[model samples]
Target chain A: MAFEIHLDNFTGPLDLLLHLIKTNEMDIYDIQMVEITEQYLTVVEQMKQLDLEIAGEFLLMAATLIHIKSRMLLPVSDEPVEEEDEDPRAELVRRLLEYQRYKQAAEALEALPQLERDVFVSRFVPTEIADSADETVSLGVFQLAEAYYRILSEVPAEVFHEVIREPLSVAQYVQLVVRQLADGQRHSFRRLVAAWPSRAELVVTFLAMLELVKMRLVEIDQVADYGDIWLKLRVAQGELAAVDLAEDGFGYG
Target chain B: MADLKRLAEAFIFAAEAPLSFERLCLLLERSRPEVRPLMQELLTEYSAGQRGFYLAEVAGGYQFRTDPDCGIWLRKLSKERPLRFSQAALETLAIIAYRQPMTRAEVEYLRGVDSGGVMKTLLEKNLLKIIGKKDVPGRPLMYGTSRQFLELFGLRSLEDLPTLKEVSALDPELAEAVPLEPESDN
Candidate 1:
């Protein structure tokens, strides 16, 4: 496009009208027909010359403007074509006014305080596992688990395809991890993830860790300023229950 | 059968994004106390076997997702549609996505142009959000990329962004037209 139009305030004819009003400081009800029409035409001409992909909204505004300009030029225009009829610019102004209000409202709404919304701290939490081994590092199981789950929410709705297959389970590795933890009270999360053979094993291992976290049967901790997260068998009351990997579904990947 | 496990599975399977325990609870009309444990137990049983897919939480929700190793294959599968966005939108979005909690003024200041309408349009498309008010004289609305931006862009985090050179190479002309500053890649 010759005129780098980035789908700005004029996604629709309505938004363009609002922008003209706000930027040019013209009152909606009393739009200076000659000047307003020229500015609107400038945008349309720009779009046309640049071969910008104009949305229908912009076209609709152009047609409305031409009609208003023609009406403004009609003989005895002040004779009042229809006393009860809408002013030629009324519909456009109405759209402009409403859009302006909401545009401001949207800005205002954003001005209010937000809760739980994240502003990226711009600090990277160095992956502890990466410290020991730095290669084609796939995302952590938890991160992948998350990325997989929201498959469609961020993607367009039309892209959604139904899945009829059953979910794969990591029962074997889950059992193995349980066993390893049974003998020892603690183990490195890095070691566990690294031990997995395939992507499936890695997922299963993470799932086991998640299950333990949920059941409160174990606690995975990354001490402040510490690197790797450690998984320790959960303690009950005042006593740490001796881990029993053989009884639970824990095994190697 | 409406069994709790099946319900959870269906929710996970049918979801377009992760379904957190709270979301599952809200969707199922079950108490969190009951559903949380059910999720745990089901998660435990599901993990006790080998499978390509696993249940995990991300974006503050939970859903069934394929294993990480499958990302390459998954990317291939998703590449079919080959999502497209206008260059100006992407440049404007890149600035907002990574360097957010920022205002329209700041965005324009960095990009050196009028983003008034571009910001508005992005907000309309739900690709960006008005996160909060900046502590300035006007308290302009701060902007950030939305979750929908993530889904469409296929970015797991801001860090998922390609190296500046690589991303710039995708459309060198546009990159030259609107070269982004590397300051905010922090």
Candidate 2:
């Protein structure tokens, strides 16, 4: 609450929009642009009156609002509206919709069991406490997301040192892996990536295997005991060369 | 017809859950530049007022699913009396998957559940493990997910999951298909 008052001075554009929406109880979809524009302009007026010079960013938003206001004022034609000729509110609506989703996501995150040391310590899972542990031994190695998150926190955010400017791409990593695995040599998963220059490279290389798994590019297995985990390329270099061809067949488009 | 490709249909068919751009590209061996716009175009065209089904990303991969209106049919298909997953299970699973090698006490604290039994079920299901023991006061055991999870869900890897929005978009069928349960299984 204290932060809200202070943030008003340096708040971002979305914050302003949200403020206006809350204050006026404005229906976001059917906003009274003229009224909103008036109030918005008044804020600028107040800032000027207080001798607090404002940035051009707010002014730009004001101008954009004015333009949209004029368009909203325009009369509807008898001819059907083209998809492109829809209300200027469309883009604004899109952003508002997106922000709404983000808001909901943030709320959902709030409800999540925010745990310490990977264990939830809240009154969160009472209903799920029922156990049926009369079963067999299980083998799972579940560290991935948090592992990366920790890695992200520990690594320097900005790598100024020009270790390797070019990213170790998924495609190239796959090639390196396929060749090494094809050479009949067992590659230690831990040892294979030890020489990587930096953390991001390590991440990119890890991501490559993940991509391969998605693409059915390789088979990863861990036999009984703490033996060296194995990853072998599924096919030859020529078969693997169908990178572009994948787009043609299974392309997202 | 040579230039025309039913890429969307193909993606839905192959993916385990709902897929993301990065996952899709890896699956198709394409770059973002070549895949994103085309996927957008295809998504718009395919889902334009369609009723029986919708394309969306969920969990971490894509799959063709029956329509939401047809959820009653799907509900019937699972044949477990629509046994909704327990919140404790979902919470514990999400916690373990997101933050793993955790101890039983750590899970109980986060879930606020005496998760000894649920942990055991997950263990029996081969979905969890005692990834060595912590050298703490009680020397508690740590838990994590198994590779069976990826295989069971038909995912090749964890990177297959899109962001939340993309996941929802990846599987609008399930989005609409869902019942009004208080908590969705994570």
Which has the greatest DockQ?
2
lDDT of 1 by residue, A107-203 (tens): 3233221111211111133557436543333233333545677885677667568966435455555556666777557798878788766676677
**Cα-based lDDT at residue A236, candidate 1:** 53
Cα distance off (Å), candidate 2, residue A221: 71
lDDT by residue (tens digit), candidate 1, B103-122:
88776644434577777777
Per-residue alpha-carbon lDDT of candidate 2 for residues B1-186, written as tens digits (9 for 90 to 100): 322236545755554334566766765676878877777776675562385555543334444444444555545444345323354455566556656778988765444336788888877666676687898888878887665444333333555422335222122232232232242234
At residue A134, candidate 2 shows an lDDT of 31
Cα error of candidate 1 at position A193, Å:
99
The local lDDT score (0 to 100) that residue B174 gets in candidate 1 is: 20
Best by lDDT: 1
lDDT of 2 at B175: 27
DockQ for every model comes to 0.01, 0.02
